[model samples]
Every structure is written in C-alpha cells, then in structure tokens.
Target chain A: MLQAAFVLVGTIFFAAVVLAVFRIVRGPSILDRMIATDMLVATLICALAAEMVQHEHTRTLPVLLVLAMTAFLATVGVARYVTQQDRPGGPQAEGGAAEGSAEGGAAGDDAAAHDTTSGRAAR
Target chain B: MSAAELLDAGSVLFLFAAALLSLAAGIGIVRFPDPLSRMHAATKPQILGLVCALVALGLQAENGATVAALVPILAFQMLTAPVSAHMVGRAGYRTRHLRRDLLLRDELADAIDKAHADAAHHDVEPDLPGLVTDEDTSTPRP
Candidate 1:
C-alpha cells in the first residue's frame, strides 16, 4: 500500500515537470524561460528524493544534491548573460536601434542617451 | 496499531503530501506571468516540500549513516535555494527586462542603476558583492 501511494505521487510530480518544460519552451522572454528552468530543477530534485524513499536506496541523495547545484549555477549564468545583453553597447545594441541604417546606429545612440538622461533624472 | 505500523503510515502520508505540494509549486511557476510571481511559487514551495519529504525519509531510514547523510542535504538546500533566487531576481532587475506592472515598487532597481552609473563615471567595473569575478572589463576583449 505504501509503495503504491508513492508511485502515484511520483507520477503526478513527473507530470508537473512536463508542464514546466512546456512553459520553458514557450516563454516569451528570456527571464520567463530562466524562471521555468529553475522550477524544473527543483521538481527534479524532489522526484529523486521521493524515489530514494520508495526504494530504500540511500545513494540517490548525493546525486540529487549534485543535480540541484548544477541547475542553480546554470540559472545564475543565464540570468547574468541576459542582464549583460540588455546593457548599452552590449550584444543587443543593434536590436535597440530605431532604423536600419547609420540612422539606426544613431537611434541606438539616442536610446543610450535617453537611458542616461532618465537615469540622471531619477537620482 | 503497532509502533512500526504507525511510523509506516505517517511516512507514507507525509511523502504523498510533499510530492503533491511540489507538483503544485511547479505548476505555479510555469503558469505565472512574471518573474517575481514565479519566484513566489518557486522558493517557498520547493523548500517546504523538500523539508517534508526529508522528514519522511528520516522516519523511514533504518540506520545512523543514512540519517547523517540526509541531514546535510536538507541543511544545504535550506540555505542555498533562497540565495539562488535572490541572485536571479537581482540579475533580472539589473537588466531592466523584468515586467514593471508586476512590481509594486522596486528600490533595488534604483540602487543598481545608481551603482552602475557611479561605476561608469569612475571607469570602474561594478562587481556584485560576494560574487566570483572571472574577467576584468577594464581590459580590451580579444
């Protein structure tokens, strides 16, 4: 009876992980995607720990920790990359441009100017 | 009921509840539209669910070695999950990509921008406190 109950709960947790994966794939923004990934990692850790209890296996706990730590690092890395890209003169500078010519380059410069101006005003 | 039977019943019930709560937390993260809300779903549920599951495991564990191993895993997770969430949220705020309508007010956003501006004026690379830095931005990248 106990084993059956665990299997049922484990299946539900697995389904939730699948739902989170769908969101990660479909998230409109990079931030949303990172958030989904972080949630997915946590769910995976719980599932592994549950399995260890059901099977009476002690080895799986360390494996779960390693996986969680790796996922945490990956989420932080992606968040850092996204923040860096959004900075002025960063990789997404072109995307911030208003036109497709030297005018576009000027427009990107204007955006940077606006950012600095607003940044100053807020101070 | 016997002592062994009672322990078995409690362990099974706790494990089941923990698993369900974890699943709900995952669903909340996926369904929430913004970073802060998703974070709300992520941090609390994950920590609580893990604690309950670990407790259940502790109850079922037969020996001292198994209990010893489980305790550190629980402790480390309790400490680390929140720190990681804070880092991700700070990064999102610094990038200015987080959805604004979702926030009531953001004092951290103001602070980060001010720090960045100050660093820019001084020609210094702003380093996040306690973070390990790999590259110095003052040098030209090859």
Candidate 2:
C-alpha cells in the first residue's frame, strides 16, 4: 500500500512540475513567470516532504526549511524591479516591447488602449 | 493494522492531498488569465500545500526531535507567502498586467483615483505617503 501511494503521488508531482514549467516558458510577462516559479517551488517543497515520508528520513527537512524561508525573496525582488521599471524616470520605461507575445485571445492592443483611457479617467 | 501501519496510512493520505493541491496550482497558473489571478493560483500550494506536506512529514517522523524540526518550515511558509503575493500583486496592478475588463471591482484603482483627485484639488502633485505617482498608471504598456 505504501509503495502504491508513493507511485501515485510521484505521478501527480511529475504532472504538476510539467505544467508549471510550461507556464514559465510561455509567460507573456515577468510577473506571470514569477508566479509560476513560486508554484514550482511550492511543489518542490511538497515533493521533498513526500520523499522524506517515503524514505522514513528527516535529512531533507532542513532543505525544506531553507527553501520555504528564502523562496519569497525572488518574488519580492522581481516585483520591486518591475515597479521601478514602470516609473517614467526609471531606466528602460519601454520595457514592455520585449515582453513576449500575449497569450491567446487576449487582444493585447485592445487591452492596452482600454487601460490608458481608464487610467486617464482615473487620474 | 498496528499503530505503525496506521501512522503510515495517515501520512500517505496527507501527502496525497498535498500533491493534489500542487497539481491544482499547476493547472491554475497556466489557465488563469492574468498575473494577479495567477498569483492567486500560486498562493494555495504555497500555504495549504506546504502545511499538508509538513504535517505528513511530522506524522512519519521517528522522534519528537524530527517533528520539532518541522515546525519552522510551516512557520516560515505562512509568514512569507502573503508578503510575496502582495508585492507581486501590487507590481502587476501598477504595471497593467491584469485584465481590467474582467474585473468586477477594483478597489485599489478606485482608491488610487480618489487619492489623485484629492491631491489634485489641493493643487499639488498626487503624492500620498506610500502611494506611488500616477505616471506609472498614465500609460498602459502591457
């Protein structure tokens, strides 16, 4: 039964990792990629715990602790940098041009136009 | 079943649940339309999934020392997940990475606009403490 459980959990984790990797590679924005990275890390932590449980060991628990403690730094650092880039005075204000193609059905131009108009109204 | 077998069974169940949450997060991150939505997708596995995983580890631990060592992992995850999510969500909003049309309500934008209006009435730049400038929002560059 334990062996069966491990196989089942391993298959699920494998599928989850694949999906997260797909999002990371296909991101239209850095933030999307960052979010996917966060998910991937969480999955990693869970997988580590699953491994420890299966092997009946605690050696990897410290790795789990370190990962949980530091993973947020990447998200926070990227977010700060993105906000800085968005500022007019900040370097490379036109950073959006390099931002890969939009995901399907989003109509990037229409969204950009709507955002500017609404933003103006807000201001 | 013996007590040892019962504990093993419980640990397997908990681990299974955590893996399922990870799978859900994977699907959510890909399918969600925008950064903020994707952030929502990522947070569940970061918190609840970690909790379930750690609980499973604790159950399978051979001694109190091992279980004690698991506490800090859960604590750190709980402490940091929201901080990172908030920062990312704020950045996403400021950078026009969300689907404005899909939003039923945007309290942050309304609040920012209200602050802007108030600052404008005072005849000064819309600068509120902790609130950034409208320059970022003035142009949509997604």
Candidate 3:
C-alpha cells in the first residue's frame, strides 16, 4: 500500500514536471526560459530519487547525484551569463547602436541635448 | 496484513506531501515575475520538499548504512541551495538589469559600485599579472 501511494504521488509530480518543460520552451525572455529549464531539471532529479526509493534501488543514488550536480552547475552558469548581459557596457551595450539607427536618431539627439542642458544647469 | 503492518504509513504521508510541495514549487517558479522572486520560490520550496522526501526515505530505509548515506546528501543540499541562489541574485544585480522597483535597497548594487570604485582608485590594469588569471574574470581580454 505504501509503495502504491509513492508511485501515485511520483507520477503526479512527473506530470507537473512535464508542464514545466513546456513553460521553459515557451518563455518570453531568455532568463525566463532558463529559469523554467532549471526548475524542470530539479524536478526531474527529485522524481528520479523518489523512484529509486520506491523501487528499493540503492545503486541509483549515485546516478541521481551526478545528474543533480550537473544540472545545478549548468543552471548557475547560464544565470551568470544572463546577469552579465544585464550589466552596463555588457553584451546588451547597444545604446550607441540605437543612436545610430535613423528611427532612433531623433530621440538620441534629444537625450544628448537634455544631458548638455542638465550639465549647463549644474554649472 | 494487519494494523501492525502499517508501520511505514508516516513515510507514505510525508512522501505525498513532498510531491505536492514540489509541484507547487514548479508552479511558483514558472509564475513568479522576476528572478529574485523566483529564486525565493525555487530555493525555499525545494529545500523543504527535498527534506520531506528524504526524511520519508530514511524512515523506510531498512539499514543504518542507507540512512547514514542519505544524511550527507541532505546536508550538502541544505548548504548549497542558498549559496547558489545568492550567486544568481548577485549576478543579476551586477548586471543591473533586475527590476529595481521590486527590490527594497539594492545592497548588491552598492557593493558593485564600491568594488568598481576601489578598482579605479588602485588603478588596477586588467592585463596585470595575477590580477585575473582565474577563468571567471568578467573583464574582457585584449
């Protein structure tokens, strides 16, 4: 009876994980998607560990550890990368490029003009 | 089996609770708007969920060695989950893209500024030997 309960609960958890994978794939932003993927990986690890317990398979513990470690490291690495992109003069340092675009040139000029006026006001 | 055969019922209940918590965590991670909020959801729920599940496994484990083996994994997870979340949060702040309205003070933002100011005061060149030999250096190489 206990084993059956575990099996049922584990199966439900696995279904939720599948839905998380879809969110990961369809997230609007890269960070959103990466976070979803990280959650999916974590869910998968827990599910595997639970399966091992349900089956009384001690050998599977090592495999679960390896997978969890890999997923954790990968998630951290990607999060770091995305965070770096958010920095000033980071990969998204396209403020200058936006200025060069004809459609944005007027706004850029206005910003520059505002800066000069502010500087003069400060003086 | 008699009522005496239900000795491991608590383990089954805990396992069920853990599974439900994990599912809630998955929903939280997907639904939270920002990284910081999501990090809160991810770490806290996962830690609780894992603890519950591992405790249930430990209760059902037949031998001392198997239960003992479970201890280290739980300990390591408890220690590392918050550290990983901290790193992700710091990285987000350093990048300056996080939604400031969501944050209260932005302590990390101040820290990054102080670091940059200290580096500037020291006139530390990026090419200086031993300054950035490590692989994780954020400064671009010539």
B74-139: candidate 3 lDDT, tens digit per residue = 666666566566656655544333444556685744655677678788997333221111133223
Clashes of 1: 0
lDDT of each: 0.65, 0.77, 0.58
Predicted model with the maximum lDDT: 2
Off by over 4 Å in 3: A1-4, A83-123, B1-4, B112-142
Q: Output the better candidate (1/2) by lDDT.
A: 2
lDDT, candidate 2, A3-112, per-residue tens: 99899998999899999999998765678888899899999999999999898877888899999999999989988877534432123423322222232222433544
Each model's TM-score, in the order given?
Answer: 0.71, 0.83, 0.67
Could you report the DockQ of all the candidates, in the order they appear? 0.28, 0.44, 0.20
Docking class of 3: incorrect
Q: What would the per-residue lDDT of candidate 1 be over residues B28-131, giving only the tens digit for each residue?
A: 87767556677777664467777777787888788888878877777777676776787778765555444455567878647767877899999998765532
lDDT of 2 by residue, B1-142 (tens): 8998998899999999999999999999888876778888887779888889888888877789988888888899989888889988878766666666677887877888887899889988876444434454445445
Poorest lDDT segment (10 consecutive residues) of candidate 2 chain A: A97-106
